[model samples]
Target: MIPTVVWGTGNVGRAAIRAVDAHPKLQLAAVLVHQPAKVGRDAGELAGLDRSLGVSATDDVGAVLAAGHRAVVYAASGDVRPDEALADVVRAVRAGAVVVSPALYPLYDHRNAPAEFRDPVRAAVEEGGGSLFASGVDPGWGNDVLPLLVSGLGSVVDGIRCQEIFDYSTYEQEESVRYLVGMGQPMDYVPPMLIESVPTMVWGGQVRMMARALGVELDGIRETLERRPLESTVRTRTMGEFAAGTQGAVRFEVQGIVGGEPRIVIEHVTRIHPSCAPDWPVPPDGSGAHRVIVEGRPRIEVTVEASDEGENRSAGGNATAVGRLVGAIDWLVEAEPGLYDALDVPLRPAVGRLGRNQKEEERA
Candidate 1:
């Protein structure tokens, strides 16, 4: 079994622990946490599992990597500390641990990523003979794999569009939801994410990845943004009341222009309250959906709705991201040492998990 370490214990990291424990071929070596309180805690307990896994959590990243684990799931947040996250992943790679993460946005398309971000990772991979795979829900699969796969259904596809429509009221990341996304901020206050060129910086890789897969050359990339104000104050259990006229909803698109048209688009319709954007597209049943629309002869549209831990879609999205990242570890360990994009990694089937339930029943 491949010995693996999971770093960070937030939304993504928590799910990573559970995923690693359940994987048949991967053994939970150790878990690394940033919080002092989380240190020395059992992996299972940190992940909110019913029972404790033998492994414990630590903060000594250098020592953990030095132990020579075969794989590292870097589940730390990169939004606030991109440079630090990159350095941490580089250290893991240099230690010869195949690293899979959803953190580094720039490295999602390493080939097209800027030299500053790509060079260090490449050097680390070369130095230690390790590999890296970066991915997430929206930039990860919603725009890259899902759209490209769905486009195949059309004989004459004219355009491809991927969307993330979600209500953020249940999302647990209070700082990001309230500050980074400007949920409670006045309309005049610009959220960092909606700043000029930021959308392109974040989601453009997915656009390019899809365009490349479709054998289309993008003329350029473009961005569009629209925000709405709360009609009335609404209180939440986690976050307090969002005052009237505050930023309640945002809709934006990163368009990959092909033939002078926005042929490939990555759109996000995010709302702090469901009632804020009644006109905008919403999930069919719940609070969130990752949708892929192929606008062509057949006009195909597929919606993916996921919920976890008391119908929380944000947690559900994070869990799916963990699934993609963790699921690729075994394959990455056996492959050549280098940075791999989403398209480079095949989404392998759950071969071993097919009979897992039956086996559990037998054991019981």
Candidate 2:
């Protein structure tokens, strides 16, 4: 059996723990936490599992490494500390552990990522004779792999577009909602510089992955971010009240270019309340949906209505991505090592089946 260490005690970390707990070939050996308050607690209790797994949560990374685990799942913070987390992954790889991470920037924005972020991890993994793989849901499936799947139906291709529309009210992550919806920020808060260069930071890699897969050399990418004040108070499980007239809705559009011409456009919207913008197209379900459109010999469009469970139920897009990563770990471990994006991964029904069965078994 593969002994695994899970890093972080957050939403994705908890999900990873549950997934690792259920895998027949994997054992939850340890959990590493940065918070002093979480250290030395039962891993199961930390993950809301009433039963103990014989593993304890600790702030000691070295101790966990010394325990002789074969793999580590890095499900820590995805925002500001991603680079640091990647460094930790490199350390684990150097210590002879395969690493699977759901960090956002590394998996999608590899080409333009800072040397400090990418180089050390690459060097460490190579030197240690280990491998690292990163993936999530949006860039993983909706934009990256879905377009690749659609490409199978045609010979020539013109352009590709992917979109995700979801209600932010039900999402339980305050930081995610604030980040995506631009809440509690000035309308003029010129989005972070990284966002401007790479199309709003949320779906940059999705566009890049599609362009690369189709052999279309992109000249540049452009982004447009817009938001409006919320008309009424919005409530979420995490955030009780987003006061009326606050900056609570956001719409982001990214366009990919080839020789100064727009070839592909990807759009994403996160709203705290429903139908905030009537002019924009909304999914029929009002929950959340992913749509992909391919322009080629025979133009084809496919739309998937994801269930409001697992990651989709809360935490915005990150949760869904986390779920995808947890589900794919079984097959991903055996795949050849390299930088893999969503297009490189397969979405098999069996993975979902396994996840559901595991959850059911846990309850039993």
Candidate 3:
């Protein structure tokens, strides 16, 4: 069994702990936390498991590394000193442990990443004889892998676009709302300059990855950002006074090259409020709708209606991302060394079904 340590006690971290607990080939060795309040607490309890795994959360990084684990999952907030978090991962890797993270900034278009991080991280993993991989639902799977999969259906493809539309009122994380969707700003307030660069940051590698897969070089890339107010009061667990119409929406676009010319375009749109969708050419698919449009010799459009399993749509996406990550721990640990995105990671349908089985057993 692969002994694994998990960092953070937040939503994604807790979910990862639960996944480690149920994984057949993986064991929850230790839990790391930065918050003093959570230190020494049972990992199971933190994840609402109501059972102890004989492992407690600790704030000591060196002590956790010395515990003889082979892997660590870093699920903490990227906005909070990502460099420090990267250092922690590096330390774990130096101690001979592979690392997987869901942090946002690290995977934002590899071109924009500082060489200081890219080189050191790779060297650390190699020095320790371990590897590193990063992935999440949005840039990880939704935009990158999903589009690549859609392209498989056709031989000649002109362009590919992926869209994720859902109501953010149901979202509970303040950082997620503020950073990913640009919440708390006026409708007229344009998204931050960094927000406009997300497509290049998150999926820029996707453009490159696809370019390599399709044997084409991108001529140039383009991006745009826009926002509008909400039309109705929305309820959420975190905020009670969202007002009748107070929210913002943001969009990102990337056009890729073919034959030394621009031929493919990819777009990502996010809205924090209702009616914020109407202002855009393509309105929000409020029902957790995801669409992939392929324009080529054999034109095709595929739409998927994601399950509304949770109280709100945003929660459902979070849950899906968390669940999938947790379920894949066993397979992920065995993956070969070097950087890997979602496309590089294969999903084992049987492993996913195990999660479904566990959920069913819990409900029963």
Best candidate according to lDDT = 1
Could you tell me every candidate's TM-score relative to the true structure? 0.97, 0.84, 0.83
Extract clashing residue pairs from model 3.
Answer: 108-201, 109-201, 218-257, 219-257
Every candidate's CA RMSD: 1.6, 3.5, 3.7
* Residue-level error in angstroms, candidate 1, position 350: 0.9
Model 2 residue 9 distance off true place after TM-score fit, in angstroms: 2.4
- Candidate 1 lDDT over 161-233, as tens digits, reads 8999988888888988988878999999989888999888888988899989999999999999999999999
- With a 3 Å backbone cut-off (N, CA, C), the pairs that clash in candidate 1 are none
Whole-model lDDT per candidate: 0.88, 0.69, 0.65
Question: After superposition, which runs of candidate 2 have C-alpha atoms over 4 Å from their true positions?
Answer: 48-54, 109-113, 137-139, 179-181, 190-195, 198-202, 307-312, 315-320, 327-338, 343-364
Better of 1 and 2 by lDDT: 1
Q: Considering only N, C-alpha and C atoms within 3 Å, which residue pairs clash in candidate 2? A: 137-321
